[model samples]
Target: MHHWRIDDARQTLVLAATGERLPQVVYWGPALPAQENLATLHATHAIDVTGGMLDANPDLSLCPEATRSFPGQPGLIVRDGEGTPLLPKFCYDSESNGNDLRLIYRDAANGLTLTFIFALDPDTHIITAQTVLDADAPVHLHWLAAPVLPAPQHSGEMIDFSGRWCGEFQTNRTAWSAGMRYRENRTGRTGHEHFPGLIIPCTGATNTQGEAYGFHYGWSGGHRMIAEELQDGRRQIQWGHAARMETEAATQFKTAPLYITYSPSGLNGCATAFQRHLRDRIITWPKPDAPRPVHYNCWEAIYFDHNVPALKDIATRAADLGAERFVLDDGWFGQRDDDTRSLSDWTVDPRKYPDGLHPLIDHVHGLGMTFGIWFEPEMINPDSDIHRAHPDWALGGEDQTLGRQQKALNMALPAVRDFLYDRMSAILREHPIDYIKWDHNRVLPMPDAAQTRGSYALIDRLRADFPQVEIESCASGGGRVDFGILQRTQRVWLSDSNDALERLRIQHNAALFLPLSVTGSHVGPRYCHTSGRMHDITFRAWVAAQRHMGFEMDPRELTDKEATVLRHVTAWWKANRDWMQRADILRLDSADPAVIAEQQLAADGARFVVFAGKADTSAQIAPRPLRLTALDPNAQYLISLANQQDIHHLSRGTPALKSGPVTLTGRYLMANGITLPWSFPDRMWVLEGKKL
Candidate 1:
């Protein structure tokens, strides 16, 4: 079952059973426990945050303010929330004097969907409650029923782990996220041992010490994901990871958690934690239509202002070199370089190509290839033809409407959203275009589009508009990446940070519950982003190969050696697409920067391994016993590899892998580990194995 074992400290829960359909969703969280002490909690009134009765009650605490609450009514409100109304569920005033919180879950029963509300209180150590009906129509309730974080005041003060934790944001290049923190017993008497839900917010409250923070990092951007925060002296707590009642698609959410020193003693607990339950279903996008293998991009070659011929040349070279789709990154449509004009025009620049975009599409298609184009349609240039034609289309700002690139669309506006729908749909329908790299460049600096009239209606229109389109969400690089979006699209561009080793951390965190298919991991060049780490192209590709593998560099620019290696890698992913695209991944040395991820598909499953030797101090690696990840225990796998040398293998498999009762690890041949060319670039190979 894809349910959570919240009662267990280890949180044992299955994500998906083999042969399960993709885009599978599973709910986790301990079933509501019987309340030993149930009592009536009351508040005079609840503020409507969905712009319905939207207003700032300076009297009450607001978001980014830990103690403030975005009060919801006694019942839930779920109107086919397109994007505004934020979300169906919201935090209401819990009796802890608004400082305390109670969580509520609302489901329309139409889809068995759920919404959350977080009301947090720091004073009496008392967290209160609510829940809305799971009936048809809008659904709302108290956002949080149980205290995700125990009231700090009631708990012993021997050690307060609750404080703002800081770390790098997995997506945006220029930001850091911080949230409240609190520590729980390693093993608690209740089901949860370490903690129920640990949150580190970007914006929240602080003391006169000027240390209290707010969950404003991503918020100031476009506020796609909502978070609330506050501080209690050195100890802080936050309510982040909030979804707008009006939300995007479901996805592998990179709940970018932060870890900081509470008392300068350094991190006192395990760096890992889980709040959500595993989704039983896997999400699958159709394999690359043209590449035959999952495609990659070379935008690294041309960020924007990509010259037509240059791009054409890149596409031709990539296709010849066995590459699939050559994605044209930002700068084709609007007056992009400086963000000036023509966003509503969705046309190929006449100057860039006298022949128009059709020629390029034709050229790529002519080469037995597919063409992909990128667009930040959600945004508008302050000086674009669209804005000029209809100024009202842009979200009107009183103080100043937030704009990413000159101007931003009031996605909350029906006409504006319809304009987008018509423009993009018409473009794709008219052109020979096979793929659309739909990107949301920046979070609305003023995410109050919902503040406008009919904003949610506009969002509904957009959702209905782009079903056939293969859109990839990019909140400035993976910030908007999530399961909500996944339901509509095939994959997510994991993180904008192209650090290969950093990817290990991200992919690990993501795959902890997400399926292997939804991840879009690309093999990029060395100049990308190196956090003082050693990264060989081989290592990068190997790490990426585990997911939906693709490349980000222009093949024409590749060194002779690099090109040769990439060609082989491309062929490998193609030949072993069956295994690479679908398999339970096994990593031999996950902790080491260098990792070897092997996958064994169904017996009829393809077998492949992504070898990234990031941690290679020596040229030689001792191969040891290798344990299979998703192979049948009793099934015999005839692994065919090795130089006939002293290739020391890995020592052993996880004890679970060795257990016969566990089908995933049992039948598969358990070899120690396989060693590869430590010096040579990484490799993706299709190993022929037989089921015992």
Candidate 2:
């Protein structure tokens, strides 16, 4: 037997192989002692054979084989060029181990090679694993999973995400059983309906305490996830590109990186690891040292009605409201007056901008804010000039149903990517633009890995040519969000629905894997256009302030008092953004189910801010004391109610926090927690704390 182990500060994963068979992960959890013997541990990891079972259990190898009669879902499924299923039994060939581990296995009889690669980030505590398959001849791949990993037997339930357009990141909890909890997203993009993430809490794990494991399949292309509990009591998780995504036969197939982490300190531990890994390691920021600017997007404000003078006036007002980056959303190009036409034309609409975009961009610049424009390069309207010229360029059958009056451009074609790059590059070359709101408005007709790869290529090319230009991945908001898309973009439009009340829950839940630096949360109009629910300026602005702060509403609609409140919140966001950008968003466990609260704890652990949003009415009469996390119990902190002025006159009793700032130990604060003045539903409370 051969055994190997990979260790980081927080976790360790051990793999073992018998004879020349492929290796399997035998142990994965909290950091093990450095002097422990992996070989002895692997030997002890085996189970006894039962009456109804075979004499010995088949190894759940890196690529479990149907040839070996493995009872669980195999790690791979493939066929020859003629569509004949080939069940090759991969054998251990070679291995490489260091900070990263690479193991190769070969099936000489079938002329196939299977490889598993693993890399652990020491600081972020995230483990990245992937699988690659190479064949001597062309083959058809039905499914290719990333390096398969064992699921914790102690985990009672598994949490996966599923939701609709505005309602993204809704968690679905499934109890562990003797069968598979299978989920597949064939929407072509990382659909809002099925986010590629899973969290398994060991037994009684909560958001703040206990042990948990997190996994995210980082692919913008559609994906499939399997959480299977075999009859032998072994559990495994498999994540890969959606089955049959590769339409054509090929010699090689590869799975996207699967990020894994084990958290002994509960779900927040997993959250922080993913957050730091994405922000500090995965993303390539154009201006690393610059603060995340206050954003102002125009989609909700004006829709497709683009008048140059009106937009200029709006830009000025947005700047006055403390917006440092003005993003001109959709309908800026291709004679696009509405969503019905001019999608892939990719040229400035002469009707909308008589003098090109210079005057408006200049006005935005004059107001001391950078300019950004929108583009939907991967889509085409049937009536668009480009679509008219190249009808064959669109993907799927001609009679396929349309979304948003448009079809996805055939991104797999080189000509299509070239057309988008050329048109987008021309605009960037001419305009003094620093950002692009790269929007993918609709899902593809079918899931295709090549199409997703093609889209990545175009964005990669654009990023290379204009290294300074930032991109925001917006797929009708939250549809295309994942580490794969985030690799090429700087920000993400979290949701199209700018309803602050809706956003409070969305942002809170999304904090599991998203950081404030890339999550774009915008304050919408007083009367939300999507949900048609009106919210107070204080509540709206604070909700926006929770992440990458922005405003999507018409500044002209804000009353004098409303504008002042917005400006104050915007200023506060600006002041705290420097540290908040790198801060860890810790979701607090609210005793009241009605409240959604989170603490943005600074990276250095010196300060933090808590946003307690009362999403609905509480069952009890008074407000519950909200507890904080990741604090030094012995340290004293100076706590103050940041939005004490927003306290309504109906709140008669003066709570200690309502009157003035209080100095308290972290122990007392975390144990007894901080109680605030009573407030009605739809309101929010902001509390600031600093180490004293």
Candidate 3:
């Protein structure tokens, strides 16, 4: 067998090929020494079988061939116009760059060519793979996957996420059982039900120790991830964009790239590597040097009761509470007083804004805060003027299901795409809009490739024309949060539910891949609109301060006491926003499930912030000693309470926490955890420390 291999600093990928069979990856993980021979290593790991053995050398699953007996899912599935399956066989050609590798195969009988490409990021150990297919004549492609690998041995449990609108990013885990476990999202867009990332923990792995492997898909449209266990006790895993393909003349097919990474230092290590890669490579931070603005969105504050005078009052109060951006959410344009009608109409409602939004925008600007508005350009109500005028623009025929009283637009059509883009562009050109809260309220039934392509084209054109305007992606909130969408927008609304308790967990899971700076977290009203749970104002503000801080409540209705807390929280965020944006997040492990802790350590080791929250109390009354992570052990530090009121209120019915500044070495703090005063349910504390 001929062999080829690529080695980055931390990992290695080895490929092998026999006479005329296709090349397959035999080894991929921790790096081996350069002196070690690839051929010898493949021989040592390859399974050999005697007569009548189903697990023969080639079929023993070193990464199966499409037509062979590896028995899991195939990497490629296609057929010709004559209804015959197109199974690609090996061709004798391959090539490699320094950290990239490519292999070519073909089915000459079917006039089809298949090529596989792999690239590695040296620093983060992220390997990206893509597949390309070329056909001399028309073909029908049912399913095409990027790349597949044998699941590593000793991997115990699989960790994934599942949720709905208000309950986004709920973590789930199940034992790595024997059959096939698959996840497919056909929502036309990344749905809030599941994120496009998965983590497999090595046996007995924890948040801080052992090893973990991660997989993430870069596609934003319909996608699938599969984990199949074979009879021989091996597993195959793969992921890619999910599409229905029928070849056209002069058209080529390529699958979206899939990314994989491994870390020996466990889940935290995996998170740090991904966070670094995303912040440095995938996401383009708008105003990187500036702190994320403290926004006040009017969705929950005033809902559809948006009048010029009422909005002006909200703007004045929002600015007084230190909000830097005042966003008028929904009901400003069209006849959109309610969700039942008038989506495609882009003009401002004449009755609500007789002066054409200028007076309100001027008022917000005069208050020293930027003005932003909401737009759901890809939706249309059947009762709207645009829909009545152009009835063919909706996704399905008369039998289509309506979401939020609206239907999806047929973005695949050029005329429809042009109309939406022109309407949005005209608004930007006429108004001094600082930001746009772009929302998608529904999912397309059978979305076509043209629709995805058209959406990208429209966004790209809008960005090119208005480079200064920032956009936020919100699909019922947190429905479309992925690297693919983050490339065009600056921030994502994490979830529709602003319940503080739910957000603590949602934000924690999201921070696994996204930086807190790019997640939109806000303080909601005492009675959460979605969850219907009431929380203390202090608890809500403390949680929201960790992300791109915003307030989603009517500030004018806040009592004097609540107003004071809001002012304090905003002031604290302003003071620490610089370090928070650039810090490395560390999720800490606690003995109690109800007690969650996280720490943000500055990149330069100068300062750090610790957040300890208690969602519920246990049988014991005494508080446990909390140990901090990600600190310089040798350095001395001065620690103090960030908000004394937090301690005063939280410690009211329990033991009193010692006040005043304390000095301790980082080594001692990490090894021997600090014991704070007892706190009850629905309480949180913020502590800050500086190097001494």
Best-fitting candidate, scored by TM-score: 2
Q: For model 1, how does the per-residue alpha-carbon lDDT over 187-233 read when each residue is reduced to its tens digit?
A: 10101111122222212211101111112111112211222132311
lDDT string for model 3 (1-692, tens) is 77877777777778777665677677877788888887888777766566666756443322245667556677767777776776665465555565567777766766777777888788767777788878888777767777677777888778887789888988788778789888888788878876888888889877767778877787667777788887667677877666562223323677777777877767776777677677667666556666788999999988998888988998999999999999989998788878999998998889889989889999999999988889998889998999999989987777888889998888778899899888999999998997999898887776455566667777878988888888898999998887777778888998988999998888888877777777899999989879888998999999899888999998877889999999999999988998888787777776667777787888788999888888787567677777776677998988877866666544545322356768888888787766666666777877788998
* lDDT ranking from best candidate downward: 2, 3, 1
How many backbone clashes does every candidate have? 102, 0, 0
lDDT for each residue of candidate 2 in 432-535, tens digit (9 for 90 to 100): 99999988988899999999999999999999999999999999999999999999998998888899999999998899999999999999998887898999
lDDT, model 2, position 511: 96
Off by over 4 Å in 3: 1-8, 48-52, 59-63, 96-100, 243-250, 649-657
* The best candidate in terms of lDDT: 2
Ranking by TM-score: 2, 3, 1
lDDT of each: 0.41, 0.93, 0.79
Pull out the clashing pairs in model 3. none
Score candidate 1 by lDDT.
Answer: 0.41
TM-score between candidate 1 and the true structure:
0.58
TM-scores, in order shown? 0.58, 0.99, 0.94
Provide the lDDT at 585 for model 3.
75
